[model samples]
Target chain A: MHELSIALSIVEGAGEEAARRGGKVSVVHLRLGQLSGVVKDALLFSYDLACEGTLLEGSRLMIEEEPVVVFCPECAAERALASIQSFRCPVCGALTPDVVRGRELELVALELTYEQHAASATPATTD
Target chain B: MNNTPHPPRLPRLIEVRKNVLKRNDLLARKLRDRFRAASVFVASLVSSPGAGKTAFLEKTLTALRAQCRVAALVGDLATDNDAARLARAEVPVRQITTGTVCHLEAEMVERALDGWNLDELDCLFIENVGNLVCPSSYDLGEEMRLVLMSVTEGEDKPLKYPTIFNTADVAIITKIDLAAAVEFDLKSARRNIQSVRPGMRVFELSAKTGEGMDEWLRLLQSRL
Candidate 1:
């Protein structure tokens, strides 16, 4: 899957972020969805290896697994789809009208050590 | 982030939740800006193995090279079969042998252009490793994304793998010459494509006979 490639990029970027923050990354959180077209296990398998010898070497991988959610008009119910291929609702067998979530590829934020001393800056202002 | 999980396992809940694909998206945007500055349009093609991707590229190179400065980078899990095939067409081609990898990433492309001059080319075609599922996820800094399916494949390819079709800007139907040989239903194929990507453009052409290639090239030229 493209997860390996994406994972490699993450390691590279996380390394950069750690350098910017003056601390090494300890964990990398990914928002993987059912429709991001990513295989979470494949990506997890590649992350540690990809992060080897990099700034994110010891970082852990965290994933927020997203459910396949779709809107059903016949039953007027928003149902969870078991498979990406499944479109019919289990409650009413109604065909899904559209997807509400579960298709996103985003890098929301990076969590760093937030060293309290790091926030200290030379104040320059005129009162 | 080192507080405590309501229910924690030994997997170490380190808050290293960083976006892994940010670099690729950044590099892709840089590449897009470069392409726009030079007015050179780029497109990546993805398909299953033995889907005539090389043949299609060879045909396309032959047709477009005379008019525009055309080049290509072909990726495979092994061997340089595709590069050799495309080289015979007398165009600049590079082979990227991705050892043990299933798809081509944007970084590989950045490395492949080390010697070559990107400014000299008008259109660069990247033929990704033959996999419909994997290549759909990575962006290769291309202005267009062409997901290909051959006539020999089932007509329901779009329905079967809607993600690829959804990611791709266009769908290319290869090996139209063999449509009759395989009893390919062209009508059903068009409908299937439309179902997945509403109002998406399509080009049905056989790289062998050059059938319907002009239209395909015309579309490419128009994009540029």
Candidate 2:
């Protein structure tokens, strides 16, 4: 239900970048984590509606789902949790509260398309 | 027909690598720094509707105000009923009315805090909109986050909404007075909370009957 607001934030972020770079946005890459509390399907559905009248209109949202990873004290290493229902280490079964990852709701990259201008020798500016 | 040739377009991939909640995170960080500078211990409460959040907060404000200056900000979709209830505690109270918004963002918390001198407060409590899901994704710049679940809710609440349990610093089992009436299994509730978030501090209390309130109040005072 909150995915629409999240999608709006994504569109706002990507739109700002697209405007600054002077190109039409083709794709938005996002990294979603299991512990981030965001559902991918809902986000995808909202992204389309959020982009209807924005710079990201017609742009595709590419989501990279990330699993929860915790730092096990007994194992002394980072391990992915087999089930988010439990935060225990899969190998040693030691419960760890130090979450190394899996709270990410980040926008990683964007694909932009620019029409080539023969008069201008410089290519599209990127930062 | 003679026409100018169209120029070929190329798609360029550029790395942005930014958090979608960066704006809220930044605002929360600023709020945290301000809280620290003002020497105010801030805590936020999240729970499903009718989980006794306002009742617990009302009792808390009433109890803590005697020892230290305590205040609260409550968020709800419509009514200011919670704020009205807490106001009886005779402490500073504010209500954030979020129409149609399911959760309280850091910006809303910041705006609600305007004109209030944090320096005069010893402790501040923010009661998030009664939601188990959406509120888990938001951080309100509190030093501690307490997620409440009434005994009547069910023992498997933590397992069902692990995300909220995972994000919270503490778990509170409210309405313990009704445990016997509702056949609420306290052991299973504790076990379920531990399963989702190991080493999480838990407080079982009833805001109505004053049962187990001393322990929770002691912890709250220690933080301040």
Candidate 3:
């Protein structure tokens, strides 16, 4: 599906950040929202294929799933939607289209590992 | 052992906080700015295959061309048939053949718009490849997005694909002429749409029978 392309973008984004920061990427952290229209399972399946032969190969993908949150005018507070099928406020049941969150498909962070070469390691800092 | 010392590698966690679709989103923002500068109204249509998107767009182009400079860009996995069909309206129409891509990205739209003077157009319509799910995630820099569902397609269509409905600015119930024959429940359809996206503007029309076209056209013109 479109998950492959999405996974490819993830790999590309993480790879760029790793390059800039100067390290081998060990893990990619992503924030995927419920209303982002992407299936987590499908994206996970595609991630390995997208990472093949890339800088992010053999890296683990950590996904943080985000639930849809909408602002309810009646409740005067933001509410997390239990189901995307209904956009009504959980507390007041008021139908509010004001989506405060849950469209996020962001690369939040990266786990990098730096290999210390023998020549670069100082005896004082080593245990 | 050698005098050289070796230390184990340490995993460092760094915050990168970036959007996965940032590239497309940036391009879309630029396109939106360009559209605003040119004083042109851009709208994109999304619907399931066989939901009468092309027919509605053809009717729209034909009607709007008489009043203003209008054009269209249609996307499909294959075949330029949609482009040819829209060309009957006698307005400039281009087809973006995505090959295997299920949705139209901002870059494809940007490339299709090349060599066209945005200043000469009052309104532009982009007909996305007909697939409800994938198209919901991509934004093509349109000022308005209309998600269509024909009467024959069950009233629960919105409930099934709430994300697309929520992302869309307007809901269009196409093939209204066949509603009675198909036992289409207009009330239920409207309720479902509102349940997923409250305060969404909706229009019920038939591109074939010319029913309810006036109201829809009025809204389009007002947007322009």
Candidate 4:
């Protein structure tokens, strides 16, 4: 599966982000789309292999699956597809090929642990 | 030892919002720039196993090499057979044997061009690993991406795997000579392709018989 490659990239990218932010990663948040051609279970299975002996070792992988949406030309409205494979419009029954979403494979956020919380909490300070 | 209470460390959330395929995309973009700078017209082919991608490529390479300098890079999981098959056309060919990976990434294509000079070649064909699902997500920096389907694969292949059709620049229906033998419905195949991506350019041909290959060659020539 290509998910292994994707997993490797995700872990590598997260490692860079962790090092730049000066913390150890605890969890990685991902936004996976239904039409992204990536299997979530397969990615999760390979996550451990990709993260072994790296900065992301033992870190949790959290995935948020995005739904596929298509813009129906006949209906002039956006439709959310129940089946990711088919692009038929839900209301108009016409095939809408204009995909607006569900191709996302983004690393949205990283949860990190710091030695001292107060020192790293810049937004919590009050004069 | 003095007993003192300490607060437990809490993890803080940091926003990344970076594309996971960014690394591959960036490399692919760099390759695109290189190809453009070298004045090379690159076309890539993708298909399911046994879709006759190598055969089509062999025919295309032989025909195109007559007037222009041509080279090819073929990918397979464990065999150099495809490379050998394309080499029969007497063009410079390389095989990228991806050990366990199902698809060829941009990095593999870049590495395969190590000894070859892109400026010397007028056209380059990258025949991807035989897979429809995984290869659809990868971009190999080709100017045109062709998705091949044989008459034996049935008409609803586009319906079953819309992602590949959506990603492809053109669809080639291969093995048309065997369409009648296989009872392949050409109308339904065309309809299915249209349903997936309206107004997509499609070509049908049989490399074995050279039927409809002239038109396909003309399309390639126009691109070059």
Candidate 5:
């Protein structure tokens, strides 16, 4: 499945972010849009397999699901798009309007739990 | 050498759970950068088996070659038949024979175009391995992507495989000559396409009859 590829990108991307932050990453957060063409279960299943040994090995994936939205031209209203494109408007029985968003495929950010040692009370070198 | 009841064999465990495809995506980004630099437009075609991608390519390659330098890479699970078919149109055509994979990835595409001058061509077409589901997941660094559903394939395919429709820039309804014979509903098919891709540009054509081919070629000319 393409999920395998996407999961790989997520782990690699998060791993890069974690390395850059110089911390141990605890979670990888993503926003999955309804029309992004990625299935959540497929991505989740592949994520675990994709994150096994990298810097983000134990990091958890947090996905925020976004609903499909459509603009209704007749009513000039924004509404949820029905699954399988049941496109008749709920209000007016007309074709639903264009899709403005809901196709996002992005890695928003990373959640890291870093250990910060307290600053040394005494300087090592006496000036 | 003495073996005392062979030491318990442990499975070699490497924490290699990463996706094997990331390498390809990296290469794809490089190719995309190259494409962006050169203004080379590319598109890939995807569909189920027998969706007329080869015939469509034949017609397209012939027309596009007349106007601009065009090339194509055709993928199939077994034979090089499609490649041969398109080569007859007198353009540079090659075949990628994936023995078992359901779809084509970026690496295969990268390898196919390797050592070639990308700026020499206006548009390149990659005919995917004829799968509706798996190809939706992979991006081939193409500026445009077209997913085709033949009239013989019925109108409900867009609903069945909305994921592919969602990924495509355009949808093509092929074999319109057979639409009436197959009882294909043009209205409902267009409605279905719109429902899946909302405002997606569509082209309906038949390569055999040359019906509607002119309109499709005109769009290709605009792209080049």
Candidate 6:
């Protein structure tokens, strides 16, 4: 599944972010879109495989699904779409051509422990 | 041994707003720059299986080769069937046999063109794996992306898979010669496409009969 590739990217990105923060990530927050073409369940499954040896190993993936928004020309307003199949505006029955959101695939934040903060604050000292 | 109470370890939150496909997107942008600098026009074709994408490409390569340097990279889950079928057009064709992957990514394309000289070719065509779903998310750095839907398929194909149509530059309705036999509703197809993507360019063609090949070829040439 393409979710594996997407999961790999997320893991790699989160690992980089975690390294910059000098901590081990415990959870990764993601914003998934309805039309992003990524399956959340599949991505969650692949995330474990991607983080086997990385900084995000055993980390939880928290996904927040984004809602679809369409621009209604008849009403001249943006309306939230319940589904992609039916583009008919909520306010009016006219179909809209513009889609403003619901295509997001973003990594929003990372949860870390105090041990990670300590790791970043000081480097190993050698005699 | 003495027991002592220890303070609680706090959990910290780090904010990072980054697209999960950023790496692929960055690579695609670089590839786009490279193609632009070389003056090579790149177009990618994507469609569901048995939609006649290979046949269409074969006809296109045969016609386009008469005027300019043309080559193709075809992707499939298995077998070199498509690449072999396209090679008969008498142009360079390579098959990226992705064992199980559903879609072709930018890295696969970049790797496929490793030693090829982009300046030598006036145009390059990448025929993606026959999948309407996963391919929509991966950008292969093509200047034009064509999504094909055959008349045999339901007219609501675009509505069902709007994401693919949303990401595509043009929509090609194939197997038009059998439209009447299949009772394909042309009006509904057009309306459905419009519903998903307004003002999208559409080409109705029959690769078997070459009915609308001339206009399609002319459009490609004009774009080049």
Each predicted complex: what DockQ?
0.19, 0.62, 0.68, 0.51, 0.10, 0.51
Which candidate leads in lDDT?
Answer: 3
In model 1, pairs of residues that clash are: A10-B20, A27-B16, A28-B16, A28-B17, A29-B16, A29-B17, A29-B18
Q: Across residues A1-127, which tens digit of lDDT does each residue of candidate 5 receive?
A: 5687678878777776555545566777787777776889999999999988788787788788878777788888887766735655567766753676676666776666544331122221233
Report lDDT per candidate. 0.78, 0.93, 0.94, 0.90, 0.79, 0.89
DockQ of 5: 0.10
Which is the leading candidate under DockQ? 3
Which regions of candidate 5 deviate over 4 angstroms?
Answer: A71-78, A84-98, A114-127, B1-41, B76-81, B96-111, B137-143
Predicted candidate 6 versus true structure: per-residue lDDT over A1-127, tens digit per residue: 6898899889989988776766578999999988898889999998899989887888999999997888888999889987676677877878776888899999999997646335434332211
- Among the candidates, what TM-score does chain A have in each? 0.75, 0.92, 0.91, 0.88, 0.82, 0.89
Model 1 agreement with the true structure over B1-224: per-residue lDDT tens digits: 34332232122223444445656667778877877787778999898898888899999899898899988999999999899999988989999999888888888887887787778889999999999888776778999999889999979888888777867888889999999999999999987786656557899999989999999989998876
**Which ten contiguous residues of candidate 5 chain B have the minimum total lDDT?**
B8-17
Q: Rank by lDDT, highest first.
A: 3, 2, 4, 6, 5, 1
Q: What is the lDDT of residue B221 in candidate 1?
A: 87
Model 5 / residue B174 / CA error / Å: 1.9
Error of 3 at A121 (Å): 9.1
What TM-score does prediction 1 earn?
0.74
Which candidate would rank higher by TM-score, 1 or 2?
A: 2
User: Candidate 2 — which residues are off by over 4 angstroms?
Assistant: A116-123, B1-7
TM-score of candidate 4's chain B against its reference?
0.96
Model 2: per-residue Cα lDDT over A1-127, one tens digit each: 7999999999999999888877789999999999998999999999999999887899999999999999999989999998889989999999888899999999999998875764143334445
Interface RMSD of 5: 12.9
In terms of docking quality, model 5 is: incorrect
lDDT of 6 by residue, B1-224 (tens): 23443344567788999998987889999999999999999999999999999999999999999899999999999999999899899999989998899999999999999899999988999999999999989889999999999999979999989889878888999999999999999999998888777778899999999999999998899988
* Local accuracy of candidate 5 as per-residue lDDT tens digits, B1-224: 34333333222211222332456667778878888887788889999999999999899899888788889999888999999999999999988998877789888998888877988887899999988888876778888899999999999999898878877898889999999999999999998898776778999999899999999888877887
Encode model 3's per-residue lDDT on A21-124: one tens digit a residue.
Answer: 77788999999999999999999999999999999999989999999999999989999999999999999899999999999999999998876773254332
Candidate 4: clashing pairs of residues: none
